[model samples]
Target: MSGGILEGDRNMGLIRAQLRRQRVLAGMNQDEFGKRTNYSASTVSAVETGTRAMDTPFAARADEVLETGGLFVSLLELARRDGQPRWFRPWLDAERAADQLRCYQPTLVPGLLQTEAYARAVIRCDDKLTDAQVEQRLAARMDRQSILNKDEPPQFVVVLDEIVIRRVDEAFHQALADQVHRLIELAERPNISIHIVPADIAIHVSLTGPFILAKTADGGWVGNLENQLGGIVVDKDDALATLLSRWETVRNEALSRRQSTELMKEVVKSWT
Candidate 1:
């Protein structure tokens, strides 16, 4: 295994042991600790066994209730962030474990579905990242696709606006054309679904940007919204419901999977 994988595994074990020890020191059983922490006993067990990692808020709550002087949470924060922004960890967690992923992209292809060349170009265009930083970001973005290749992979659904395909720069236009054709091929996979909204469509949900809705195994859903400033994850019941409803409407306006693929082919022809 690579050094990164080895280091990540080691950190996971450390966090698990810390959490388990604290729970036991508090004289708490799995169920009791889970009840106190607002997580399931199974989830707590997974974290403790190093099969899953804990999130920031959960780590803090665990520290407070377990009375471990906040040590575990502090250690978890240090290890999780490593060098990137804190938000990256939760996004990764959701991407890795989701049973289904639905995305609506008004501007570009969703990161998980992007080709490496396209992803690197997109990252390079972002002023926030240096050349080296863009390379790292590209690697992380590509790694996010593993969930789709797993044994029981997530059902991947993506809806793209025609504008996203139409706005490519001429320098990379041929590459983008190839990229879109590749996406059409991906849509043909049994586990994947793709939709494209017509440019002339009169109705759309999110006019300003893109978002993702991921469904977890426990009937829980989460929304990811990104912007120039930052991004937010919405797990609140009402917010998730609202996003889901809007997505349904948008999906209604998009072409069927077959028609979407045909449309993409035509769009690619125009690129040449």
Candidate 2:
């Protein structure tokens, strides 16, 4: 439990260290601590070792278990803001608070729908990322999917370019197959819908990168555009309007839900 297991992510490091110390002082191993918190030992180990991002619910549970009176919760709030690069925080907040998320991805599945292995394969594309950084991000991405399973989760309308499902990478072959199955499972939920833009689509307007428009509680929209570098949050009226236009165009190009699922099933067989 020392020397940058999480690669000197001090904010995360401090959280993990403190949690570990508390469990030790209470004479509880990870399995014992996990039982008190109603989680598994593996989950406890992941959090304590910084391989998993400690989520808010777990923080609350920890506070209750260790009688820390919300100390873990407070620390987690800071970790949430500072754990990742500064630029991504605003949209992360917006996404968490959004009631409706409209997503369009041209090359991959949206983060909200990606399976754990699929997310890991995608994040590994960045060679510069350390193992700790990748695990941190991968955990965060998996945690983000929880929003869709919450009580009365948001209405998620996702449109993906056909290649997202059709394109196969030799390295990600198995992960991609599992991802398609995950997509189908999630789409079965009433709140989730997946649409696919067929390969025949020759439109260039939607080629301007993938973007998501989230309708916040205040009835305004926030946009997140992803690229090779990072993501940008869109809030200005004019910029949001342009995103709206682009979203509408690609969404129109997408097949209906049933048709898209059928197409995905056809592509899944190709994996074998």
Give the top-scoring candidate (lDDT).
Answer: 2
Each candidate's TM vs. the true structure? 0.69, 0.85
Extract clashing residue pairs from model 2: none
List model 2 lDDT by residue over 1-272, tens digit each.
12322323787888899999998998999898999999999999988886776777899999999999999988876665566556677888888888999998888899889888988888888787778777767766776787888897889999998888877768778888999999988889899999988889877687878899899889999998887667788999999999988888888888999999988888998778
lDDT of each: 0.77, 0.84
Give me the runs in candidate 2 sitting further than 4 Å from their true place.
1-8, 29-65, 69-74
- Per-residue C-alpha lDDT of model 1 across residues 1-272, encoded as one tens digit per residue: 13433454466567778778778888999999999989889988876765444655678789878877788767765554443455555766787789999999988888888997888888787675545445445545665676788999999889899888778776988668778977988998999999999999956667667889989999789888888756788888998998899899888889999999989888887656
**Model 1 ranges off by over 4 Å:** 1-83
lDDT of 2: 0.84
In terms of TM-score, the best-performing candidate is: 2
Model 1 residue 46 lDDT? 70
